[model samples]
Target: MINNMNKFIAIVGSNSNKSTNRELLKYMKHHFQSQAEIELVEIKGLPIFKKSADKFVPQEAKDIAKKIEASDGVIIATPEYDHSIPAILSSALAWLSYGIHPLLDKPVMITGASYGSLGSSRAQSQLRQILDSPELKARIMPSSEFLLGHSLQAFDDNGDLKDKVAAQQLDGLFKDFLQFVNIFNQLNNAKEINVQKAKDFSWDKD
Candidate 1:
């Protein structure tokens, strides 16, 4: 049995108050209470990222980075915006990566919700590539994705997933993420090298 101490951060990749992606993450936090401690984080109100010679990292971004650094894993719920992720989420990532590598080599689970049937498929795919980039280098849970289609109708009034099959799928994927966290932590062969490489990629270099 997995320990209850397995803490995770679930990032709501939207700025809107009425986001279905946020709703989906809330459901997971309640449903998986026995398995892990999932904290919901918001990307709202972060300023747009711009390259600076001073390598300024916002206090908000640094605070979020500290949370991520202390957590065992991360979960991101994204909504599709024109076949991609929202600009706010993209900017949030840029802030997280600039001179700060909290997500580097972190275990991550990708989930998405959409109003249409495709269920944010394109956004998730694009997110994968972004996470795989050198600055991010997140160890995303392989071969596992939870896509919620018609998400407006997916959950009931109590904020629980109404579809049994989709709920079961999320259960399995979350369990896999727990194991992925344990396994990733065991591989320390190149941990130091990876960290140095991420730090070296900073624009505030000589």
Candidate 2:
């Protein structure tokens, strides 16, 4: 049974104010309000990550991390830049993994939006690799790709998906994500070990 009170953190992977990625996440937040409580978080305005000897993490990053920690799962919406994830999103991930690993063993779902027909496929692929790293170790849902191509016209003025097929596809994937989260929660045998492993794997040493 899908938990009615499930909480999820949706990270806006773009820093641009005119981002369709944000629109997509917003749509999901409203579209699935009854299934889950989706909170959209921004990575904008976070300082570029710089390694500190003391392993300092910014307060903004910490706040986001806490939200992720408290949520049942995570959703990331990214826009392609140079055929990969944006620098701001990368910096946010660096800050997120610097000293605290909130994403360790957490369930993640990847989504992308793009102006081109190919969507942000390359960026989403790269993001999967990044989230699978030792520092993050997010259990990204397998084969759940929600790529919105020609995103400028993908949604209506009311912010709902215009295509019925695409809308149904997203609904299916979201239902799958809910099950994935539930199964992941039940299979927590390795969570402690994974967290310990992440903590022990130092960036300098690796």
Which candidate gets the maximum TM-score versus the true structure?
2
- Write the residue-wise lDDT of candidate 2 on 65-174 in tens digits: 99999999999999998999999999999999988999998999999999999789999999999999999999999999998999999988899999899999999999
| Cα lDDT, model 1, residue 57 | 89
In the range 131-190, model 1's lDDT, one tens digit per residue, is 999899999999987889999999999999999999899888988898999988898578
TM-score of each: 0.95, 0.97
- The collision pairs in model 1 are none
Which candidate achieves the best lDDT against the true structure? Answer: 2
What's the count of clashing pairs in each model shown? 0, 0
- TM-score of the candidate numbered 2? 0.97
